[model samples]
Target: MAEVEDLLEGVTVRLSAAEEIRAKGRRRRARGRAVRVGAGGAALLAAAGAWMLLPPGDRGTRQTVATATANPFRTDGVIQMPRADELPGYARWHWTESAGLPAGAGRRSGPLPQVGLAEACPASFAMTDEPGQERYSLLYTGRDHALAQYRVIAYDDTATARSQVAKVREQMTECGLRAVPPTARESEEGSRAWSGTVQDGRTMRVTVRRWNSWVSVAEVLDGTPAD
Candidate 1:
């Protein structure tokens, strides 16, 4: 009887020890899982921040941003710029938005193809106004001239043109360019040359010039509403 009792006590001690071991194993597993989760979360947050702070463009490639106000010319899911008469005196501008130095960053002239950029440059694309803006523009310069011309295309109301110009002028000032207010410098008789800015409520402007059919133009695209 004594031996039996001793044996029973030994069994109880062994069971208790097994239970304690299981509990320790569970605690270790939980701790390891929590560490992994925390490390993963940190990595994800760092990546998101880097992406947001990077300049707006294709990664490592030269690109441009074009901002267009709401109600911009649209057809078949594509945005079309309006003629100057419809909105009046609005032109556009382009700002290069790429990291690394562009390949063909030099004097270029004449109107480029309206659609995609050329592959010859590999980098250095014109940034059009983002369609997200209230007003927007596209710009081009001559291979021979120092003046950068732009076209302002906007669909905003008729009241916001000057404000658009002021904003764009500030941006251009950073690039060592000044807003040349509209002057009759190049007007010829009835065919007037426009250098002045017009606000179409979208708050935009365009650098305008008249020479042949290929007018030199730069545009300032204004944001309509941030969606």
Candidate 2:
């Protein structure tokens, strides 16, 4: 009888030890899991902060940003204008040989079309005629006598392009023109546009967009209503 009691006590002690070990193991596993979860949360927060600091173009994973190094017209010599096919789609367009920059002239100076702005046009933001600058100009006259004049200017850097865009916007606001939604396609590079009618009963649309190293400006004057 005494031997039987001793064996039973040994079994009870072994069972208690086993239970204690299992409890310790469970506690260790719980701690490890908690640690992993905390690390994951911290990583997620860091990633979100980094994304917020990125530029507008970089925040969108699908878009490409234009850089000055990618500009194709940054040469020191004269850059030819884009071909007709390269220009934006219009009902019809034809190149005017007499309206472009003069031979060997890098830049041109002229009065900006009176678009009913309160402030006078700034000469620096006006069209550039520097050598090695890529520029194109054309007039599209529809059958209805509505005319649209388009000009595209390519800058060497995005800073210059953005500065010019800001100036255009300021001019439009000073002129008391109404702001309208942009109809132009979203650019992977960067873009700004303004459209409104002047007091002269003519509507004007200006779009400044950048692609790679090129900044293009399109000025459309329509006798018809705003589209």
Candidate 3:
């Protein structure tokens, strides 16, 4: 029995070691996401140089553009997410264009100003509604075309936004679809946002999150198409 106990102890140590190795592998995988080209720094330098060579004031023209409130932006279902550590196109956009902004909203909208995040297009879009009343929609190409991926941002308090969310879910149910019930452990990100899932019997369900009055939905539309 003593020998058996010793052997089990050894096994436990090996299992702990294995767990540590697996955790390290996961960290490495997360950091190495996507592929790196050239020597990293060199590729960035080339990209910077190309950007600088563009016609003077070209950036101002490119950024003043705005995608409509309802037009679908991504046929391919991809949005260029803004990185926390970097400046997005909002810097180039004209914050002075507050013509149709939502109520209580300043000239500046929420953190993300682009609702029509392009899939194949690289154009920048602006949040044009009034302050605190700004509304925007973002779509991403899912794994399948039948799967509908929608991310909507509406600037309003929690109750107002929640009611709208409920209404949207109700409509989805009428179409034989389900706003995927979130898992028990699902968590929120801030005072204004939460994430959930919805499904229509497809292999992939849309995962959605609302953060700081902005809503983001991501899904792969492959197995089943949107009705």
lDDT of 3 by residue, 1-97 (tens): 1122236645632234556768989988876763454468778999999999999777764763342233232235544442222111123221121
Report RMSD (Å) for each prediction in the order shown: 18.6, 9.9, 24.9
TM-score of 2: 0.49
Tens-place lDDT digits, model 1, residues 1-227: 11222366456322335567689899999999999999999999999988878876544333211322233244575545444332333233223322221234333322221111112121223453432223234333221111222332442333343343333444434333334445453232112221222222233333543222222334333432222
Q: Which candidate is the best by lDDT?
A: 2
Per-model tally of clashing residue pairs: 54, 5, 22
- Candidate 3: list runs displaced more than 4 Å: 1-132, 142-150, 179-204, 210-214, 224-227
Ordered by TM-score, highest first, the candidates read 2, 3, 1
Pairs of colliding residues, candidate 2? 77-132, 106-129, 106-130, 106-131, 107-129
On TM-score, the candidate that comes out on top is 2
Cα lDDT for residue 103, model 2? Answer: 35
Score candidate 3 by TM-score against the native.
0.29
- State the displacement of the C-alpha of residue 133, model 1, in Å, after optimal TM-score superposition: 29
